[model samples]
Target: MTEEARPESPDIPAAEFEDSDLLRPIVESGVGFRVTSSLLLLVLLTGWVIFGRQLLYGLGVTGLNQPVAWGFYIVNFVFFIGISHAGTLISAILRLSQAEWRRPITRMAEVITVVVLAIGAFHPVLDLGRPDRALNIFTAGRLQSPLLWDVSSISAYFMASTVYLYIPMIPDIAILRDRGVWPHWFYTFLAWGWEGTPRQHAVLERAVSILMVLVIPIAVSVHTVISYIFAMTLQPGWHSTIFGPYFVVGAIFSGIAALMMVMIVLRRVFHLERYLKQVHFDYLSRLLLIMSLLWFYFTFSEYLTAFFGNEPSEMRVFFYKVSGPYAPFFWAMVVTNFLIPVLILSFRRTRTIPGIFIASLSVVIGMWLERLNIVVPSLANPRLPLPTGYYIPGLVEWVMFAGGIATFILGFVIFARFFPLISVWEIEEGRRLSVAETTERLEGYLPDPLPSAPGQPVSEGG
Candidate 1:
C-alpha cells in the first residue's frame, strides 16, 4: 500500500523544523490527555449543575449571611484574579525587558492570565446569587460603589489581556495553518493573513512592544481596584491605606507561584524539559522568593500598624485574625506565604525543581488563605455591636471552587490540544535574533575602549 503524502508548506522554511517537539502535543494525544480532559470536563459539568441548584435555591445554599456576606466566592474571585496577574504582567514585563529566557515561558504565562481572568470574572455573578442582578451594575450602578470600579477595571483588564494574548499568537496560528492542521478555517482566520514576511515580523514586534507597555499599568490597576473594594470601606481590616499595594504584591506573589507550577506541570506532561530548562525555574524561583519577602513585609506592616494604633474597632478585627477563630488560617498564611517559600527558595540545596514546586504550591495555598483572611475577618467582626460571625463554605461553594480550578486546567488542556503551549515563533525568534541582541545590549552596558595612548592600537577584546 502507498503511504499518504502530506501537502507541502512552502511558507515554512527548513529552520521551522528545528523545534518540532513543541508541536507534538497539538498533533498527538495519548490516554493521559483523554483521562485528564474527561475528568476536568466532569468536574466542570458538576460545578455547573451545583450552580444551577444555587440559582434555584437562592444564596441561602451558600455560607453567606448577614455580616459575613462575602464568603468563598469573593475570596476565590480575588484569588483567581490574583492568579491571572501571573500571566500578562509577568510576560509583558519580561518581553519589555527583552529577557532571553522568557521565550518558552511567556506563552504559558499569558494563557494563565486569559483563562484565570475569565473564571475570576464569572465569580462575581456566582456571588450575586441572583445572577441577573449583575446586570444592574451596568444599568443602575453608581460611581461611588467600588463594585462598579471592579467591573470597569476587570473588564478593561480582560479586554487588554485577551488582545495581548492573541496578538502574539498569530504567527503560531499561521504556522499551523500552513501545516494544514485540523480546523483549517480557525487557524487561517486567526492568523490574520500572516505570511512571515519581513514587514509582518516588524509589525508584530511593534504591536507587541506597544501592548507590553500598555498592559503593565492595566494589569497593576486590576488588582488595585479589587483591593479598593475592601480598602474603601470603613470596616476595620478593610479600611487600611496599604491594601492597594498589599493586594498588588499578593497578586504578583501568587501569580508567580501559579505560573511556576503551571510551567513545571506542563514541562513534565509534554516532555518539554528541553525548552523549560533549569535556568527558567531558577530565575522564576528567585522572583517567587522576592515576592514572598515582599508579601511578608506588607503583612507585617499592615498588622504592625493595626497593633500600634490600638483602636478598639481595629483591635477587634486584628485579634479576631491573630488569636480569634481565624487564627489558624492567618498563621497558616504566614507559614505558607512567607516561611515555607522563603526557606525552600532561599538555599540552593532546596531550590531544586521539586522544592520550587512545593514552594509554589505553598504560596498558592497561602495566598488563598490570605484572601480569605482579608475578606471574612473584617466582615465577620463588624464595628457595629453585632454577634461574631462564622462561615463554613457550603458544598456548592466547594464544588464551584473545584470547578474554577478544573476550568483552568481544562482551558490549558484544550489550548494545548490546538496550539503550542510554548510559543514556537518566540522560541525561534530568540534563537534567530536574541543572542546577537543580548550581545549588543551587554556591550552597551560595558565601558567603551580607552583612547589607547593617542595612536596605539586598541586590544580586540576591548
Candidate 2:
C-alpha cells in the first residue's frame, strides 16, 4: 500500500478518517479531564500519606490482630489482581480468536491489566507493614513457600503483560510521531522507527501473536498462584483442591466486569459512540453474563463440597461466612456477582448501556466482597481452638484502599493524556480488512456448494 493508503499515514486528512476521535484525548485537553485527574491525584496523595503513617506506626495501626492477620490490604490485593486479569486475558483471547469487534476494546483492556497489576503487586508490600521487608521474599525467600510463588508469577505476568500492551502500540506511537504529537522524542523512541512497512507489520503481527498465546497461561497461572497462597495452607476453608480454577474464574469474571465499566465510562467521556457502539456493549455483556454463571458454578461447588463433607474445622469457617458477621457480605456477593448480573444481562432490554453499567458496577463490588469473605472468615475461624478473631479496617487501611482505587483511575487518566486509549491502527485495519476476512470465514463454514452439482451449468443461484 502507498503511504497515503497506510492506516497510520499522517497524509490522510483528519476529516476523512473516523479514528481522529481516538486522538482527541491525547491531543486535546479540557476542564473535565483536568478536574478529574486532579481529584484522583489528591486521593492518591492522601493514600500515600496514610501509607506513610502505617510505616511509622506499623501493622498495629490496622485491624489485623491474632489469627486474622490479613485485612483489607490482602483482600484488595487479591481483588485488584483479579481485576488485572480483565485486560490481557480477554484481549488475548479475542485477538487469538480473530474477533473483529475486539479492535476498539483491546487497548483499554490491556491498559487495565498493566496498571491494576502494578497496584495489586504493591498490596503485598503494604501488607508487610514495613515495605523494606518485602526484599526478604527475594533474598531469603524459599522455593517451597507459596508467597515466593506469588512474587515470581506476578513479576513474570507484569513483565509479559507490559510488553504485550506496548508491542501493538508501536504503530499508533509512530502515527503520533508523524503527526508531531507532543513529546516527540518519547514517541520516536517507543515507535522504534515504525514506518508501517510490510516487513515491520509482519514482525509486529508475529510478536503480538506469540505474546497473546503466551499471556493466556501466564494470566491464568497468576490467579492460580494467588489461590495457592490460601489452598496450600491447611487452614480451615483454605485447604481446597478446587481453589485454582475457582480463583481463575473469579478473576476473569471480575476482570470482564471491570473492563466493561471502563469501556462505558471512556465511551461516554470521549464521545466515542462511533467506535464503541451498542453492539460492543451487547457482546461484552453477554461474556459478562457467561462469566457470572461460571463464577456461580465455581462458588457453589466450593461451598457445597465443604458443606457436604461436614468437616468440623471447615464448617466453622463456612458458617462464619454464611451466618456470622460476614453473612451480610457473603450474601451480598451472591446477589451482586450472580443474581444482579444474570438478571440484568439475561434480557436484551436490560442489556443496554445503563443496565450493563449497573451490572458491571455490582460485579466489581461483589467480587471485592467475595475476596473479603474468602480472606477474613477463614482466618477469623482458625482450625485450632484459638479464640475467634475479628478485623475492621483502620482509617489508614481505608485511605490506602481509596488510594489504590485512585491510582487505578489516575493511571488511566495519565495514560489517556499521553496515548490513545483506543488502538487507532487496529480499528483502521478492521474497517479496511475485517469485513472481507469475516465474509470469507463465514463462507468457509458452509458446505462446499454440494460439489457444484457436477458443474451442471455452474448455477449462480440467488
- Candidate 1 yields a Cα-based lDDT of 0.91
Which stretch of 10 consecutive residues in model 1 shows the poorest summed lDDT? 1-10
Model 2 accuracy (lDDT, Cα): 0.91
TM-score: model 2 vs. ground truth: 0.95
lDDT of 2 by residue, 1-462 (tens): 544445454423435366787888888877878999999999988888888888898889898898889999999999999999999999999999988889999999999999999999999899995687778877889989998899899999999999999999998888888778889999899999887777788799999999999999999999999999999999889889999999999999999999999999988888888889999999999999999999999999999999999999999999999998889999999999999999999999888899999999999999999999999999899777888899988898889999999999999999998889989888888877789889999999987854665647765686
Q: Pull out the clashing pairs in model 1.
A: none
lDDT scores in order: 0.91, 0.91
Colliding pairs, model 2: none
Model 1, range 32-55, lDDT digits (tens) per residue?
A: 789999999999999999999998
Relative to the unseen true structure, what is the C-alpha lDDT of residue 302 in candidate 2, on a scale of 0 to 100? Answer: 94
Error of 2 at 312 (Å): 1.3
